[model samples]
Target: MESRPSVARPFYSTFADLYDHVVTDPVGPWTEAVEGALASRGVERGTLLDAGCGTGRHAAAFAALGHRVTLLDASAELLAVASTRCPGAPAHLGDVRDPHLPGSFDVLTCRGVLNDLLGDADRDAAVRSSARLLRPGGMLALDVRDVGRSRERTDDTPRSTTVHRDTGSAVTFTHRSRWEDGLLVVAEEHRERSPDGSVDVQEFTFRMRPWTEQEVHERLGRAGFADVVTGPGVGGRWDRLFVTAVRRA
Candidate 1:
């Protein structure tokens, strides 16, 4: 397996405490899409692996539904919160790029993870590792923002906005776009204020490749997945694409 990248650590570590507040708003579409996929596929409950599990919000939900969940993430801080939320489930600290874990799971759920890891090689490695951990006839469900539809201008206007209700602070993020080796690189920075009147800033970048619907199908098929289905685009404004696949026996 290829060595893990450095960007994987800081992104989750620094944002762990603010993860649920930033990402899981009432209007957030990813949560709905994931739950919908599980229901549509009749995933009542079983062993599930939540790669890039973050603060374990989804893991807790899965566990609540009677699924034994293994939550894996690159950042220890994130796993700490995950552990507290789902005390009975095992929360492992590891990068998704090189997930060195044992046992196969009936379902693998990865959300808002792929876009953060740059480069096709890194992304593919993560996907392959997730696939390797799935049992035969299992399911893989993931969500990715459709960067192709995002506003790509260089202006300082907010392209992505997230509000923290607890602190009563709103963060407006801006993105700068660049084309690198047939991939669109969108760099973003979040500007937010703490409850104590302190300002915190975090920067992260993601490489979005030109992946059409056909490409997703081909790639999943190549990864030993059968019956790949591209679900409806979520996030209201076409910010995300949901995909589901089943492992072949």
Candidate 2:
């Protein structure tokens, strides 16, 4: 079977308003885990870059912990929400693959960003860019889909879920995913009905390339990072591969 080319809709732009509602990951625990890793490396608090900081969830958490947090994401809308959410934190609109930010930081978190880069070059560039943005011996933490686990538990069935909010608005999300050429392609549709019965529909397609543990180790090493350590999923999700590394001094 061949994969068809479709226009990539601006996902975050349309999904920003519904993000906090739909995404219920345990952000506090995830941030604490990353902070623990930093503490073990002797870093109490310093400059931190939240790369691909969607809606600044983790950024806000880091900021609340007294770290000087900086935000970066490709989506302007999401960045805006994050900026407002974490007031006083510097925000940059950029992609993690080539984040053009100023200054090397003491810590960088690129959570849930790498899998979105379906191409090898892009993924490599992202890791290298992360290294470039960190000072010598700086720490980096990120998560990606675990290729082996994900493949063993592949679910190709189409599914739908409807979420109703207390504000009298409801959104029905339908999605179908398949593996194509070793990459996961997901097609999603979101239909929202307002209190006045006005309805809006948005459709988008996204692809992800899960990484094997070996590949992650090799890539981090090639990107000028050392002391690479793979950890359990940040929020206890078995399908996620959490990793930490330090920039070579």
lDDT of 2 by residue, 90-180 (tens): 9999888877787999999988789988878998999999999999989999888998777766688888878786778888877888888
Instruction: List runs of model 1 lying over 4 Å from the truth.
Output: 1-11, 27-44, 151-156, 159-206, 235-237
Mark the 10 consecutive residues where model 2 has the least summed lDDT.
1-10
**Model 1 scores what on Cα lDDT?**
0.72
| CA RMSD (A), model 2 | 3.6
Each candidate: RMSD: 5.9, 3.6
Candidate 2: global Cα-lDDT?
0.85
**Which residue pairs show collisions in model 2?**
none
Q: Relative to the true structure, how large is the alpha-carbon lDDT of every model?
A: 0.72, 0.85
Clash pairs detected, candidate 1: none
Best model number under lDDT: 2
Q: Assess every candidate by TM-score.
A: 0.76, 0.91
Q: Which lDDT tens digits does candidate 1 get at residues 142-241?
A: 7765545533422334466565645576555445677666566767676666666666666776666645567668777877888788755666635556
Off by over 4 Å in 2: 1-11, 164-169, 195-198
